[model samples]
Target chain A: MAGENALNFQMIEAAAGRLAGHVRETPLLNSPFIDAIAGRRVWVKAECLQHTGSFKFRGGWSAVSALEGAGGVLAYSSGNHAQGVAAAARAHGREAVIVMPEDAPAVKIANTRAYGAEVVLYDRATGDREAIGAELAEARGLTLIRPYDEPLVIAGQGTCGLEIARQAAEAGVTGGDVIVCCGGGGLTSGIALALERTAPGFRVRPAEPEGFDDVARSLASGMIQKNNALGGSICDAIVTPQPGELTFPIMQRLCGPGVAVSDEEALRAVAQAFLRLKIVVEPGGAVALASALFQGDAIEGEDVVVVVSGGNVDAGVFAEAIRTYGDAA
Target chain B: MAGENALNFQMIEAAAGRLAGHVRETPLLNSPFIDAIAGRRVWVKAECLQHTGSFKFRGGWSAVSALEGAGGVLAYSSGNHAQGVAAAARAHGREAVIVMPEDAPAVKIANTRAYGAEVVLYDRATGDREAIGAELAEARGLTLIRPYDEPLVIAGQGTCGLEIARQAAEAGVTGGDVIVCCGGGGLTSGIALALERTAPGFRVRPAEPEGFDDVARSLASGMIQKNNALGGSICDAIVTPQPGELTFPIMQRLCGPGVAVSDEEALRAVAQAFLRLKIVVEPGGAVALASALFQGDAIEGEDVVVVVSGGNVDAGVFAEAIRTYGDAA
Candidate 1:
């Protein structure tokens, strides 16, 4: 499948202008405990605090607001992107249809519906959500918003990198690795492109879960790769089968070497964030943080900036993480 | 003992200037679900994300920075204040000794010590902490930084209020109740003084946990009132014996009627914060949020603001809160 055209900083600036009042500028947090564990200065960009509990909202708002005479929008996701697109569509006074598997968490479905999105549930084993989404969009005149392999979406995610560039400078961090939890590489590539122009001294590193380190393997081999297995890891948020067609090229051009951490490390990072940083972070969202703290030898420099991309985990999972790793973390 | 002299907004402004680089300007958050529950617009000031995981950092920095060639500092707190003062003191390259009860949580003690402070453990059943703190301060020639009764501390906490006024106005919220989790009334009175000058349209309201509703009772009686029992509720962070002498007068003159909520309500608020806002809120820190969501009738106007003052909680407590109230919230 083909992807959208390349993005530039100007597009990100335009997206920023469009998203000024609509998107939140999430805080950058650090704890001495986190720094001590990482053996360096560790700053966490709390994107989990962003609207819809993820950085996906930036892309969602950017795409929805840029629409011309929009009828509505359609998206297929069982996680952050669904709520993000729904909320953005509702805020723009346009309808949104979200296609999700029937087996997805009930809370996620309810949250998406709460944002005024029309949720179309399909059987994950027998039905294709993309097909359902496309049919619904065609019938309703709804624009299909791809999760990551889209230009405006990448530009929206780039706004986060812009903030990091400025915030790191403000915090006296002129040079560091900006670690991002990678799924389809939208956030990772967008940040790389943003930092390429704004903070060239800083580099972007894509961090993935251990068994799903396709981005890491792809970066090392200088070619895109795919994950063999998909559904076992607890870090489901960043477990895409492969990198995005649009984002991979940008990442290859701009990002540093990729990093990966175990699911246990991700869960431990979730516990530490809850204990020391006083924020809710899901296993997938904590992967970047895990790489920053546990895989410190893989990264260079005295300072590291990690983006916690989202925080929408089931209560049982969160409970298990905290109970199992809270003390040790 | 008599309290320190009354404070003014200028004092808070001076504290802000001193704390420009030392303290974090915490974010203000809101969720549509929260607003739906309240039947109005509700914004939460996430002081839990502040340095030391509480707004106490502001006052700590203010007190520590205002010192003139100080020898060192001494403080008494079993929770947030201990870590806050320790961190502020460490940032200033000054020695600090924190006096805590032996029965206090080991994690709190370890966190305080981790901030480079000397820990002095006293027997809660037999030892007079005040006498021990005074003696140690006198012997070591260290200045005693009071938790809330001191003028500089109140001025420090008021910095949070200054930010709130500016942020609320930016959010198009001109008039509303600014609810606070009250303990010694330091944070409540400090915000009242600040908003009195910067945002007169906004009113401060103290929210206390049930059975520890000294501030609410005191506000009703127009005098200082003490809680019948001190150590029972899960909301231990804001469970003060009584309102401060310095703070009561300010709150009486500037604050609106007080509000109170039960422990279950506070725990539920914590769960809701974790789910919707993706921020951690301990039971004590969540009372104001509980009041805003569950006791909306006591508040006025379409827009209401609540401060989640701190997020230093035990894993067991937090896990229990999420397990019991996560789905319902």
Candidate 2:
């Protein structure tokens, strides 16, 4: 297993340097209405507007660019990471092969292919995605770019925390909890590590959908935990089976308590983001925001920061979110 | 009438200084899919993500901050400017009274009021909005903040142009057409003036909805023109009776030929922006992007920069847009 010592501020700073000019420095946004709802000053880091419509691009670029050889890369993801890796590989002039489930959103599949990646779709219920990815990597001599566990990928995601630290200061936010949507604890732990060195007063908390709260359970139990099922919930982008072995330690050492919200709450946050912030956020991407807005009792202090992680949602789901909760928000 | 000499680079620079911390420096985004659709490199300046969901906030803050006294401000707008001025006024600890038509989007009116502005509703068919605003201003000793026909407001809007020039250069765009959604020629003229000074090689082109092509006709004829109908298209934010006396001269001198697109094309751009850029762009705000994507034969360049000016769209209209064109995009 990867140790905690493998990731550090210097590595993150180096990743920041490598990722410069390639990654977008998404802004921190807030609205008075959101603040009113949260009953605090809320600052949102809009990573949803990041390249590839997610924060995964940062990690993908960091890992892909860190490679020294001319070999291609491989990854397995339900959606966001696949596109991120595809785009990053294309930018670096290296081929990418993505292993995704057949039932993945058509938008995600089309977008992945549009980025020039060869996509291999498998049945989620019967296929072993890891074995498929491993076989393809070995057969093609491609480096498997792990979504969250890799040090370089974590370091890349830490760049977003660096931005949050800087932008929060600019927005006059001294300190608060920074909530991140947790899949395999990649973004949550990466941001936690980044804040540990930069904004020491700010805490990182992982937010997950209710049925897929493996990260939250693991954090509470102080041990590795797994979800009973992986395929439920509208938040497909953040329905990982368990916390990453490499990431769990960092999250345990640095992050605050986890927050889990329902899928409906996630959709509500999506609608609120569209109505107030003029940005698109998927159900998985809005969990952190849902926790920030609705689960206020679980949080502390008068200020809070939330990262809107991604925006690779289907049109039907997005429309339903708006139709159901557009007025209430 | 406001003269062209009243607005200049120095004034825009001063406005930029005032707007440094108050306004968001929205980023320029592009997707490979968007570039493919445009048949060239396309850069979208996402002003829709600006505070108050539009670039109007920049001018609102500029005009409100430039005021010499503690008096409140008064303005009449369909929506975007009302919220902009209201937010800016509240930010400056001054009162704002907005005269809006009753038929305007409820979201805009509520947003304006939420910013602590007192909203006065008028009938679009029978009541004269300007008269109501003028009487209110006179009775309450409030300064009248014109939507576009004022030097300070124009200079404030020019700040967006300055950002476009700098951001386009950072994106490695040397020279290209910068298309803008035009209403009373405010944003168009402001961007034209700013680009003329900062990026001499870049040209500005005003884009409007099909029936509301007053600015396009005026540009072609070298004379002022007016639209016969005021309330026709779903792009209500950018529908005006005619170009501003102050703005027309700058646009006439600095802008290229105008471009007009169908409302269907604007809605398509809205759907495309939602899918590709992960940002909400209302129909009026998407016109420039629509022209940039659909009117390729009229434009000349390897690269084009288009500004999505606002995103305070109603849910029904936005849902319809997504339903109609989401698959097509």
Candidate 3:
């Protein structure tokens, strides 16, 4: 366990060094409105503005860079992570093969292609992308860069937490609760390590979307738990059914209590961020803010840091989401 | 002429002092994609993220501050400027009375009210807002804050240009063509002064909406001009019939050749800014970018600055605009 912890921290540091300047140091915005509503001073870490519009770039780039001279990389994702891997591969001047579900938004597929990635489509219900991805990797001799399960990828994802800690320190928010939207515990695990290393007293919290509360249940059970019926949350980016093996232990050890919020709350938070801050945040990116607003009592009077994780929603989807839940004003 | 020039400059300086910290120093983003299309280095001064979501805030705040201790302020605007005055008045702890056309989008009216202003509605065809505003001001002893005609307001608007110049200087854009979306020339005049003072070699240009090219014709004729029909452009914020008396002379002295772009181009520019930079820009705010993309050959090889002046579009309008012209993504 001690050796594993040391390795995790070392990997995160290495990932940070490797991915520097390739991704944006997304703004950490001070929100008076959210603070008023939550009864806490809230600072939002806007990773939605990250390159390729998600925090996945950190892990994607980290994973690809670790392969060093690996000829090509492969990934299976329906959303932001796919774009992240594609963009990261392009940045490193390597070919990327992405296996996306057929029902993926046309914009996402086009964006992946625009980044010079070859996209292979499969039916969402009938196909196993992991199996297909594995086959393709073996055939092409390309390294498979899993979206979240790998240690290198988790370490890369932790750079966001490192950034949050750094930004929070600058804003005098040391030792506060840092809430991140969690899907497979990849981002949560990474953030946990960052908080533990940089700000030891700070509490790292994972916010899971309602109906897909695997992380929350896993933390309570002291072991990873699967949600068999994982309905689509508005936070599609973080709607994984189970936690990653490597990420789960780190999250269990370092993270604090988990919070859950409804899809409506997430949509409202996205609208608020867009209208008030003039930012375009996807539903998934607004999960942290949703947690702050809906689960305010959990973070009462504690200076809170909510990570806005990505902004890659299609225009049509965004319009529908806003119409469904946005405040009239 | 010299006295008028001195007055304009002084008002701008005073407005800058008065409105400091109340407004954002919105980012001036360098657009690689736009530059590639235009064959020029295109930099966008994103004022769309300004307080109240438009450059109108500068003028609104400046005008209200000039009224010093006035109990209430009154203004007539269709949207962005109305919200600007309302919000600015609230910021200064004064009551605001906005005379808006009833035909204005519900969102704009709600936004103005959200800023704590009293909204007085009048019919666009049957009721004259100017007459209504004057009567209200006279009855209540309220100060009348004109949208753009006043020297103080122009000076306040000029601060946006001042910021653009300061930001451009910091970014090492020493000399270039600075393009502003033109309405009544308030923003253009203000920016021209800022460029002349800070970046002497920079040429300031104004971009007018197609079919509403009064500023372009005015520059050519050395006098203010008006268009008979003015509803063709998506740049609603800059569809003014003629340049203000105080603003036209400044624009004439400092502005270069004017350009115009279609409504489709303006709408597309707004979508591009949102996708690329994650900034919400209104149609008028995107005029300069539209001009750059559509009229690329005009500024070939030159470093160009396009001022994205506002971002207060209604959700309905934004949805329609994107559906019609946001095919670029």
Candidate 4:
């Protein structure tokens, strides 16, 4: 609770080196259509295309691979990180125990199991998953991996920003805004730190779902904030009650006051992505693009980088996303 | 009507250079899970992520850019070519008039209109779209662009193979099998020509939907063949009655015996793609992947490159594909 995000540029570079053969160097995509919608040039780092269908794989792999003990790893996540840990652990022939919420998508739970992890579901509304995870890790002598607060986890996610730095250099850009979907500030803080060292002129703007905008509220008030509710959003991939202790301070230092997007706007972004970008994006993943398209006046930068964070959602949800808002095409 | 696929590798390289900054360098993806299922390394060139959500964009841009008189362009397509022509013509500030089947996906018609093309729908069961297109082209003084037989079109589609060659070199693979979805063999023939010149060790194998396996039948016999029926398969995008006049020759010379997948297998591949690859692949575009997964004994390659040619489908169709086959994840 006391320490800064402490991840430096060198650590992130080392993580990149560590993850060279293990993780995907996800592509950067741009469309004139997306640019027109935002009224400016916008680039999208398509982490939705990453393994485990999210950028969470980077952190999960970084943490799992660095585990020196033979006991393997234990973690808690709604879905994306669950699959990430399971997949990374599988790659290394290590064991993974994922404590997931019962309300998480069936596809997510199934994917985590298919990746060869032992999964335990808990009632997210009534049970404390973190406490359950700690008990299991202690009982089994397994190393517990926090989703965003862990130093190695933060370092791992920063590798994405490092790749962005190199990719942006290739694209002849020294500066811009990186709009990242936020839950607990892990990816945003890590990316901001990475940019501060390597890409100097780039800034981070966290995008959040409307009611669960704790990070955005925290950024504006200069204090930790909490959402009044948690489970109503369609953006299930990212719906934290508050920012992580380790991530909040760094976000305070590096990111602007974030923007929040409505569920309707996120669905619209999902449809636009499917229509024009030809990719599948979940509600949480589309929030950044939603902010970029709908909150243009509030954000800064002529050239913006919107991170499409994941593409894992239920069939009915995706259908609604496409059928309801597809006419926007 | 009886010429060969006269596109040389140099022509493809020229098209690539010509279309630089205009066309996207689509990413190549591979999944270990997919590899395990196929019992080999299957590299997927994600042309679904390409502009207009298909490889058709390449040919459209290539032919449109080479237009000398600039009377605008006219084409007859089921759907993809309509979008390709619309997108390319819009980019070049030229008019595009597309004769599409009236039964094509509503999304396809919407996308074509979004790109500013004038669409004329014809009944596939009763009318001759080619004749309608030709008549309109002559009447409106528009240049008629054939789907696959046009030399420039074939050369343009070959750019995908060109990029694959460079990407394969970077990945240190000298040769493999290139599995391509075939309607009239535009993309398949173009890639065959490109690979023949650049990576001679790689063999081409065309994949088609079961009921519409004209190309596969044509490859088996020593002459052009036609499907007994048209427009029954779920793969509405690739339902050509027969192989193209120009494309068939190149495919016959360069490719091995082609494989065909049932509509069920194609749906499974689409679901698998969504679950594992986190990409949206339409039914026709998924045939190559379906063949690779289900007909592995027929294909010849230690390393396989499956061209996921397109990702344009109705929301309901995609939702059904996901709900039905996504359980494999």
Ranking by DockQ: 1, 2, 4, 3
Per-residue lDDT of model 1, residues A36-149, tens digit only: 999999999999999999999999999999999959999999989999999999999999999999998899999999999999999999998878887898888999999999
lDDT of 3 by residue, A115-159 (tens): 789999999899998889889999998988877888788888889
For model 1 the local lDDT of residue A186 reads: 88
Give the winner by DockQ: 1
DockQ measured for candidate 2: 0.72
Residue B14 in model 2: shift from native, Å?
0.9
Query: Local error of candidate 4 at A217, Å?
Result: 0.5
Show where candidate 2 strays beyond 4 Å: none
lDDT of 4 by residue, B1-329 (tens): 32562467788888888788778788787777788888988888899988888999999999999889768899887688888878999999999998888987676777788789998999988999878988898899998888888988998999999998888777677787789999999999999999998888888899999878889888888799999998689987888889988888888889988888999999999987887787889999999999888889987768888999998877778878887777654
Best by lDDT: 1
iRMS for model 4? 2.0
TM-score of each: 0.98, 0.98, 0.84, 0.91
Between candidates 1 and 2, the one scoring higher on DockQ is 1
| CAPRI-style quality class for the chain A–B interface of candidate 4 | medium
Location of the lowest summed lDDT over 10 successive residues in candidate 4 chain B = B1-10
